[model samples]
Target: MSEVERPARGVSDLGELLATMRPELDPDAWVFATAAEPLAGAEVTVVEAEGVTSVLRKHDLPTAGDAPARMRVSPPFARITLQVHSDLEAVGLTAAVATALAAEGIPANVVAGFFHDHIFVPWPRASDALASVRALQRDAARAGDARG
Candidate 1:
């Protein structure tokens, strides 16, 4: 279908969103940092009262000599982007995913974009986090089937 024919708002049904969200883990290592301004290759940036928070690949950061004098960098992370096109107003998606990861003793950093929801978890726990999310999707699908 053409873009014009597509639904203006992506999937809004919570069950459908959960059941169909195909989480894909990215291959690159990422980091969260606070800088005076977003660096050259940030994938996402949020401006807050404290400063600009940038999410970028680890390799994208500048060397110490070229970097900002006072940037604070977080631990390495791995990103997993949900393939499902979720509506901005959709509820429960983030909570459900986060809860699942939390149960596995993993911390989830979720970022909602216009097209997808991106999740960042500790680099060492990326695979486990992905598996947890996929299991949640499977359970949701089974529940949806039962409802049908």
Candidate 2:
């Protein structure tokens, strides 16, 4: 018999998923730089040189620093980055991850880049959070198999 192709699985059982996924540690919590400067410091990269005034006035960015430089935003959550080969934007991936985390009572913030998707969750719940995400992946795989 020829093996059937399967449709990819999406997140389903959150509890079981969290139990299986290994938690990872995130180094930096908050990264800040000038709007004009290159994105550096943390995993999340910020580009475009908008002045601090512009960020504050237009984007409602917190004015903690005095200088104007390119800003990259990543609120530290116990974060895990998945290398998704699919052409999904950061916001879409974030929404998917957030949906899974929410089911487990884990709050998450997502930062997207060109290569991978980054998820930030509360430091305390990092392990549980990672497990939750991994579970989602497994569930997706299972669903894909079922379709095939």
Off by over 4 Å in 1: 1-7
TM-scores, in order shown?
0.93, 0.53
lDDT value, candidate 1, whole model:
0.95
Candidate 1 residue-wise lDDT, 24-68, digit = tens: 999999999998998879989999999999999999998899899
Q: What is the lDDT of residue 125 in candidate 2?
A: 77
The local distance difference test score of each candidate is: 0.95, 0.52
Going through the candidates in the order shown, the clash numbers are: 0, 14
Alpha-carbon shift of residue 112 in model 2 (angstroms): 1.0
For 1-148, candidate 2 gives per-residue lDDT tens digits of 9998754543334332333334344553433334554332223334544532111111234455743444444333455766453333212445667898999999776655444456767767778887888778777667666666
Candidate 1: RMSD to truth = 3.4
The worst-scoring run of ten residues by lDDT in candidate 2 lies at 51-60
Model 2 has a clash total of 14
lDDT of 2: 0.52
